[model samples]
Target chain A: MQKTFKIVDEDGIHARPATALVNTATKFKDTEVFAESGGKKVTLKSILGVLSLGLEPGDTLSLIAEGGQAAEALSALQEVMVKEGLGEVQE
Target chain B: MDKTALSKDILKLVGGEENIEQVTHCMTRLRFNLNDNKKADKAALQKTDGVMGVMINGGQFQVIIGNDVPVVYNELVKNMKGSPEGRVSSSSADAGDKKKKNVLSSILDFISGSFTPILPAITGAGMIKGIIALLVAAGWMGTTSSTYIILSAIGDGAFYFLPIILAVSAARKLGSNMYIAAAIGAAILHPTITTLLGAGEPVTFASLPVVAATYSSSVIPIIIAVWLASYVEKAVDKVTHASLKLIIVPTVTLLVIVPLTLIAVGPIGVIVGNGLTDGISWLFDNTGLFAGLLLGGTMSLLIITGMHYALIPIMIASIATLGYDYIIPIMMVANFAQAGATFGVFLKTKNSKLKPLALSTSVTALMGITEPAMYGVNMRFKKPFIGALIGGAVGGAFLSLFKVKAYVIGGLAGLSGIPMVIGATFVYSLIGFAIGIVVAAVATYIMGFEDEPEAAAAAVPAATADANASSSNSAVIADALEAETAPKVTEDIYSPITGEVKPLSEVNDPAFSEEIMGKGFAIQPSEGRVVSPVNGTVFSLSKSGHAIGLVSDNGAEMLIHIGIDTVKLKGLHFSPKVTAGTKVSVGDLLMEFDRVEIEKAGYSTITPVIITNIAEYSSIKPGGRSAVKEQELLYTVQA
Candidate 1:
């Protein structure tokens, strides 16, 4: 299942910030959670995926969660979003 | 995206695939000629990285890449492979555009484009003259005093040598060698020739009797000389620069050119100048108000094309023959009107980004320059320009009514001529100026502006418009999910404007307050005739009239949003039938606004129509903006 969130950061998370989120999320096993912004999704670990999002500062996104740590991984990813202070994590 | 791809994306964003015409750099802007002004996504451009702002002026798209504008311009041009002088796509073409422009629009465009670059010089000179005049009047320096003479000379230098500047500009316009053209003009204006002419003897040039006119301080002769010079240069270039022809060819050409010019070009140019002045005088006399309205309405359009330079000869001729011209004074008023209208919208709107454009344009307009404002903001919004047109017509008519005139021939049709105009026409000109400002401000206030519709349409995504409709039509749909006894009352849903109403849930977006995304309920009514749910105080309403906020006596905060993305509609479809703090009964029609227009604006009528103040109550009921009698239970929330 996927839920949407609005990107809140002014500059938006560039490649570095997107990598931080993706690399941190890949730590979870068998739980595939990916973020899609501006209607395109990127792999949780692929830096290319994040940059392809072309997510602007005010852009919105959807986070898709599935598999084993889907819920836990989603929670951890939401934490990164909260830390980076962009996008509201859906309940 | 990598940095290269990012910049590539930026170029594509400007309009990919044959939209850009020419790319030129000035100061910090990358100016492009677009085939269609409407095709490019303006909002996206504003938010794009490396773009400070976007300015549309003189039929050109100006992107402010700041100090690195040169780099961006280079990058954009390199990828473009040289933008050919090709027409834009036919699908995006404007209507009824095949006919050649009549003399008027052509004249306006000529004058505007020619003067825009030279304005700084005129303003500086005019201000110096104004200061010197003040000093002379104040007894600090006599008119013939050395201090006064030096200062006045500084002020008058450009006007004295005006022929040279006009020659260079005309030569460039004709695509000829400019310096040679300037030299020909200088020959005509030589101080020695002025002495011979002052002696009042007919000088024979190659046996054709010459008009011994002093060409110094003359404007029209250069335009004619350079036009003639262009043909001569082209002919010379065709022959040869080989065989040591460089110095010898130019020298012989000048010898042939000077005699021919004095006898042929100068006199004919003077006659053309007089004819132009006569035509203007005829227009002012014959048509009066009709002329005023037409010119005033399209003044900004002229300035936008940079064609306002064509007015120079007429102005100089008027000064030569009548000692004054009324046209420049009226034009200045219209110019100010354009700025004033933009300023009005800039002040009235809630948007933060539009304010700087308004302020800068307004300030620039006050000084009698309007391209920055005209291109930057006024034309972008549809209604503000109408306001400018209205103000311009009124101002122009009033000036004509008073017959205001300017004696001095400084910066023809520019603000610098205001003092001379005031001196010639007095209280009438000043009053006309005041009238121009007042009319512009008032028209802009009343006419208002239309914000770009796309931003409001995309405010919410597509899915919410449909799902909200499903939850709204079926009470069982509401009951099956989380049923609460909504206060039931049946009243008539009358036509707000005798037009159609649509169900909010049936619309496209999925997020209203309660239907798809939020805890609040939404309604898909048959139409958009919003009636009062209960007696309430009108709270917050946007100036645009798209969304309204209301407070019930019991403190139920409700937001009666008019349409989805209707904010972009910018008052085209919606009209607030009521002001804030208006009282209403359950069945009383609170507001009458447009519903189909909301849909046409690329938004769904699936208005969340939410009870935002539901937190104040144990539970609140939801209602519809249409199809229900007054006092119907739309929905309720329990506190």
Candidate 2:
């Protein structure tokens, strides 16, 4: 399952939020997730990925989750963003 | 009655304010920017109040305020604004107007200050790249496989979309349209351009040297280009009508710049970027390892000044060419090493205020942005910065010896460069980094600087402030401190201003001046009454009652001063309290003072009120400033 989101928050992707998303996805070994745009895919577990999207408000990003926890993974990622004040949008 | 005695004691030093320009402070130093820096009775200021030492550097007058600098700097900046000259003083640097920053310089500052915010992205990506290298080396992921896709993007994402970051940073630096910079960056990083370039053969669109250095992961080139673009945008905006300016300028710049950029300019600029990388490599190869060693050691310093950004392209080029350079790891060690050194200071100091700043700033340094640490804590200490340098030197030497290299282009921050060491070099990198930390810490501790949080105070006055004998009131006799000497006769007589007074021993703070219990006294001063502390001529009192210098009937030279950092109040409400040649009696009021307004100005009311000429007296008794009545048994100096 894949979902798209725009990094709507002002500071773009950064420290606490980026670290939160990366560390969260690192917990799921059976499930793999990544963020993509323009055919370039980056590991969802990599803090560098979310930050490098350099995603500013309105920049749409697709989050791809593979395997059993795909829907849960997307929901969980969104929950993390909401909890940590990241992305400024639902997954 | 030591208050009057203490007041009298103070009347004999440095021939007061007619001498000083401004007085300020750092943690351990009282920094004074003297109007007539020459007239400053440094010996007097040092002896006044709770002074440690004075250090003058880079046009900044410094007082070694000790671990209490931030606290004291606030006070000093508030108080030291008193220019005895009463001319334009830094105190006039009031809340709002002093914001007069050099517009261009601050822009530059922004570019440099902004680097740390995005460093984690670069480090994480670089580390992932290193991990990917390890993975491929282990045959766990084929280079062309989907697994490689995920991992490569994980590592390469930052560099791949680097222009986006540069755009935001450039927007901040240029202070121009941020989104415009990002849009322009997007134009530069457009996939069509990448796809076209990947078509392989040299593609020529036009001839403007649209030097596309592939803004993807390159640090400097994009920054420089965007900065230039901003200027063009600015200039174009001025000429075109407001509405059309933004639309036309960007459109024209894109249209004309694209084709032109593709041909002569693009290829040339690209070459320039490549050449820049090669030139650095050339320097490394030709200069021997000396170049790496030099940069590695001083790069932290350079980063402190933000000049290190100038070399980012070189490191990037190294990644482009040999895919390796030793500088980043060296910088990493230097960064952490500096943090470690500052951490030592944080550990050794007992100062309540200094410890937290040291810890926080050191953490920031470990994160690779050292400016806050350097400016906030280390440089203030004087030795920690030196410790950083020593650490850097050893680390540089180690890096040079190990010949370790970095495989990625990134900010010179963090341990991301560790895994990029490739082959047997990893061990050397680790060894070098360890040696750096150890050398820095051991050197800092062993240098005997660890115990002295107040080191600035000790180093402050070793050098004399003035050599011009003709200019200053040379009333102070060069006699040393004598415990049993008789009171040398002088025209100078200092008086306690307030009515209430007591023995100097009653007011407490670590005894008067080392080992002497309140030899210096305090007065429970009336909020605003100024009296002549001495009977001697007011050798100096340049209009502001903030300070007064007098020569006693006996030959003692002293100055009676008021309030800590009260000089910043700038004579607004306080009366001159006295004149230079005023004749005074023990009870005669010299000048009406204002303690309320002084306190209102955010200054410490704990006025030192001391005698600058203590060396002349065998033993000045404790006349408490707080309890003794006027003209009581203040001082019984032996004659």
Q: DockQ: which candidate is best?
A: 1
For B267-305, candidate 2 gives per-residue lDDT tens digits of 565577777777666765666657656776797777544
Error of 2 at B502 (Å): 22
Q: Which stretches of candidate 1 lie over 4 Å from their true place?
A: A1-91, B1-117, B172-175, B275-298, B304-307, B312-325, B339-384, B401-430, B441-639
Please give the range of 10 consecutive residues that has the lowest summed lDDT in model 1 chain A.
A45-54
In candidate 2 the C-alpha lDDT for residue B133 amounts to 82
> How well is each residue in A57-84 modelled by candidate 1, as lDDT tens digits?
5778777888886877777777888787
- Displacement of residue B288 (Cα, Å) in model 1 is 8.6
True contacts kept of each: 0.00, 0.00
lDDT of 2 by residue, A1-91 (tens): 8777767655545433555676557556568999886566778765434444545556677878999778877888877766665554543
Measured over the true interface residues after superposition, the C-alpha RMSD of each candidate is: 20.2, 28.3
Among all windows of ten consecutive residues in candidate 2 chain B, which has the lowest summed lDDT? Answer: B470-479
Evaluate model 2: give its lDDT. Answer: 0.54
TM-score of 1: 0.47
